[model samples]
Target: MTDLTPPAKRPANPRFSSGPCAKIPGFSLDHLADAPLGRSHRAAIGKAKLKEAIDLTREILGVPADYRIGIVPASDTGAVEMAMWSLLGARPVEMLAWESFGEGWVTDVVKQLKLDAKVQVAPYGQIVDFTTVDFDRDVVFTWNGTTSGCRLPTGDAIPASRAGLTICDATSAAFAMDLPWDKLDVTTFSWQKVLGGEGAHGMLILSPRAVERLETYTPAWPLPKIFRLTSKGKLIEGIFVGETINTPSMLAVEDYLVALKWAKSVGGLQGLVNRATANAKVVWEFCAANPWIANLAETADIASTTSVCLKFTDPRITDGETFAKAVAKRLEKAGVAFDVGAYRDAPPGLRIWCGSTVETSDVQALMPWIAHAFDAEIASLAAAA
Candidate 1:
């Protein structure tokens, strides 16, 4: 007896991809008109633009004055690889993973780097116990599991006084959550995440301790030019000061600048956090009101505000993967949502992005459509049977 009729209300913006998320509410190509086209990145104009991006990032993120922020190649993956190749292998390492991306890092460390790292992992909806971890060893973890829709509630478990560094992949969490900067020695993110900027650029923020590690420790293996952070046993200061190791996409840089400006106008980090929190609340409320669906995150505290994952729990459902895909397809076909399917490696469910660029009203509008799609899919399954 479920109402299968489509919802008249539809989200104006249907981009809900966790990465390369929805653009700012009023984003326009005109914002990038000032991008310096056809100019060398090393030129004065390019360097100035890049420096402004760095300065604004520090101001918005409230990064410490002694920390270093650099624009690196690739996206978040590149930034993470660069940090691992350059800074790890200096000490005993422990890798924590609860999602696909984190598992990839473990593979890189265990198989590629051959670091003999101790790896602790949990199921998709769960997180490893932070208290049981040894902070004395170099620790690498994701602040938010992009694929799992689970996140660390706080950085309190990390000790203030530890012998090792804490490297964090915070691509989806930055700008949308409270990041404990003091506890993180190396944090990496990409332009395409919360800000909805273009890709091919990564932000690498390093604490003083990370810099000391870079300057003193050298990996046993030779590093590629792009991964190298130190030269002649000294941290490459220019890399942190607008001098990139390789050429960059000025257009993408301009897009990031525009997004950063938008972030500031929305009250910077706290503002961005509020928007994401509110957006996710809409979906959380929807799940609470509906008995057939629920959050994929086992606990509310560990649930992600940016990539809010969901699972259908109807007893009538059969073949979870196909049912989830059918529901997502119905929503997509109805033009109410896009890219709402769960990650392939994750539990069968939906992953709706509720990042800062997404509006609360749009999320409110999309929830009804999800119910509509679910009802239609369920009826179709019954007919097929």
Candidate 2:
């Protein structure tokens, strides 16, 4: 096979960063030419754009009438923290953790909430034993672990008749996977993931049960005005409307609108799923042919269709940390991909973002370059040995 190095000065292609994935493939500055750049977010026109974004997201995701969708503070992390702070004190909580993002919530529950809690955790590449968890307690988990590239097969594993709330950090899984909306009490994600939009905001969806919990139960910790979901113990109606607790960037709101429009034009949620599935398959096929490479995730069914985790099989670099760093650097130097590094909190393995915004053609181009990088790195290691 031929080495896949580009001629010197070639521009980046197949960029595989996990957060801000490729921007709508052919996206250009022309798309933003007519955007209102200098308008106040509180203006009638800006509010109208925000309202449209909320409606489009609701329609695209098939969100139920009983739920409340709000554009909230920060990105995915902020939305999750708002939910945790605003909604937790009512029930005994169980936090499920398998990767960095999941573990972040666990830290918030134990260290920040100081709640009476239990943690169910597993190392990178492994999943928590679902059978061992009690559904009667409030549960927090990531539908897809972007860092580890592992995901729960489905929300079906969650007990149907559980009395406590189910809160999910679905930033990476939102548009790319099938979410059992009936089972989720609270869900949070960001536009920067599957939609490939500007960050700085998060989307928080709350089921009726969650709203009821907020109305009846109050958290002990002091909540910022922005995190409060209720006005004098009554759910806020304006949040679901065009009203926001704090000002939001109009530009980001416009980007989200553009992304939602693209998502709908491509056939809505199912189309997004198809794009992610196709991109991930390209990586899977490459892994199957490469003897020295394998997915860090164990099973095909459990592996993420959004972020594909991979690692080298070289025995000499048995330390996952060493191998992951070497391979990532080689790929970066070759210009095959960028920010294709392992999560600092996750076990060492490359995490490639394969969200819907990333193109399958880009992934196809990336695979051969990956093989070339691996061969070059391995040879260098042997030479040093």
Across residues 173-278, which tens digit of lDDT does each residue of candidate 1 receive? 9999999999999999999999999888999999999999998888899999999888899998999989999999999999999999999999999999999999
Q: Please tell me which predicted candidate would have the highest lDDT against the true structure.
A: 1
Model 2 lDDT at residue 7: 34
TM-score quality measure for candidate 1: 0.99
Q: Residue by residue across 70-94, what tens digits does model 2's lDDT show?
A: 9898899989999999888788999
Which sections of candidate 2 miss by over 4 Å? 1-12
Model 1: ten consecutive residues of lowest lDDT = 1-10
Global CA lDDT computed for model 1:
0.94
